[model samples]
Target: MTYPHDPIPDLSADRAELFAAAAAEYDRYRPGVPPEAAELLAETLRDLPDPTLLDLGTSTGQVPKALLKALPSLDYIEGVDLSQQMLDQARAALTPVLGGCTLSLVQTSAELYKPLAPLPEEEWWTPDLITCCRAYHWMSGPDVLARTHRIAAPQASLAIMGDGSLWMHEADWTRALRDLVQQFLGAGRRAGALGDCPKPVRPFQEELADSAWSDVAEHRFPVTRSWSPESVLGYLRTTSFAGADLFAERHAAFEEEARALLDNLADGGPLLEETAFTVLLARRRAGAR
Candidate 1:
């Protein structure tokens, strides 16, 4: 497949390293793609005899692990991420659950990933389903989408899914936690070496408007998550905004304060978070390929 844009620098290095130090904590504390969202993606693959899947930004392999369990028809999967640590975690987690399915974990940014060519007499190895869960915001959207369109099968479907994290949620304890983070790390959200993570200039729907993958469907799942005071501390350590590196020598101090604050807010009960997981499923416009 030929690319229209000029060869771009490997920008995924920063995104990959953003969570490198917290890979294990992230795998342990982060939530997987909700079952309903996984089922929605699985629905798109049910008709295909042997579906191939590609997951961009497969941090710790949560999305693929869930989808593999949900869809037995899924025959092969490839997970791409720039972080070797993250890829290592993904491999360990995804291998045991693969059953008869084949798996590949590539350490590269989505924008630069090129699918391996098929063998003689075979066509290109295009994926039947493409998914980017919880990690699309860090990517080069237009470039990645264009690359995704190139390597995806003609009838393939793409799903971009994520939810607001605890830092962005609206609750008394969360609000207090954000305040505490700002007090220590300043106002803007810390995103490792990138400083503050920038929000996409436009939403995904608007971004997809002129792309080949213009046929779109939106699905939202209401999710309720509970976290204990210790769990909240663990989750914070895994996030870019409130990670331990940002706190430096004050990491333990911040954890102490955060634990106290959360404990008081929960009053010995689980801290409950009500948020929505959103999935934007897209397909190529008929006759666009």
Candidate 2:
């Protein structure tokens, strides 16, 4: 939970390529898809003898990690992402437990990976369940969904999983944490690998609605995640903003200040916050309206 180093910032707006540079740090800090969300996908695919799962934005294989845990029977999972660096980390993470199933990692942005292509005769089945974890906002959602509609099996489903960002939380402690970061890094926020992650331009729902994958259903799982000051401090190192890359020579000073800030906020115990696990599933249907 604790890291001796802070995350190095990359500050590049190339959303497609932003994550790869911090691939190691990201794999260390990024949380996997929530259990409830994974269970939902598993339940939906329970009947299939051998399921194919395609993970969009499959950074470090978190999507497959979650899905395979829930549905170990899954036969193949292809994780597609923009960064080869990120996919490299994913390859290492998934190599050990691949067992009977195959874990294929393809490095390409979601936009270009044509999900609409016809199924190969001898190779495999269509994706029974496709999952996109935290990186949904980075994609051309309508295009992705439309293509998914074309390539997916008859009853295929898509699960988009996200909680909220620690930086974006509006709680008192979160406010205090942001204030500390701003004081140290100045008023402008960073994102991707540079600074703080930005809020999406449009709600994910709107994107889903605009596409053919409109049989939308949503589930919210209330969760209270606990963070130790040390772990929280470690997590910051992996963020796009606030990561060690932003401060350069002042990184040490910034971390020192952050530690003190966390100590004050911790008062006498660990920091506990109410967080929700959200999974938005979409399928293709005629009259979902």
Candidate 1 per-residue lDDT, tens place, 160-237, comes to 999989888999889998999999999998888889878678888887777888899899999999999988888988
| Candidate 2 clashing pairs, residues 3+ apart or interchain | 7-237, 9-245, 10-193, 11-193, 11-194, 190-195, 190-196, 194-240, 195-240, 195-241
| Tens digits of lDDT, candidate 2, 161-232 | 888678877788878988888887877677744345456688888888777777789999888877777877
Measured over all alpha carbons after superposition, the RMSD of each candidate to the real structure, in angstroms, is: 3.7, 5.9
- In candidate 2, residue 288 scores what lDDT? 37
Give the residue spans of candidate 2 off by over 4 A.
Answer: 1-13, 115-125, 193-199, 287-289
Candidate 2 TM-score, C-alpha based? 0.86
C-alpha lDDT of candidate 2 relative to the true structure: 0.76
lDDT, model 2, position 226 = 76
Query: What lDDT score goes with residue 170 in model 2?
Result: 78
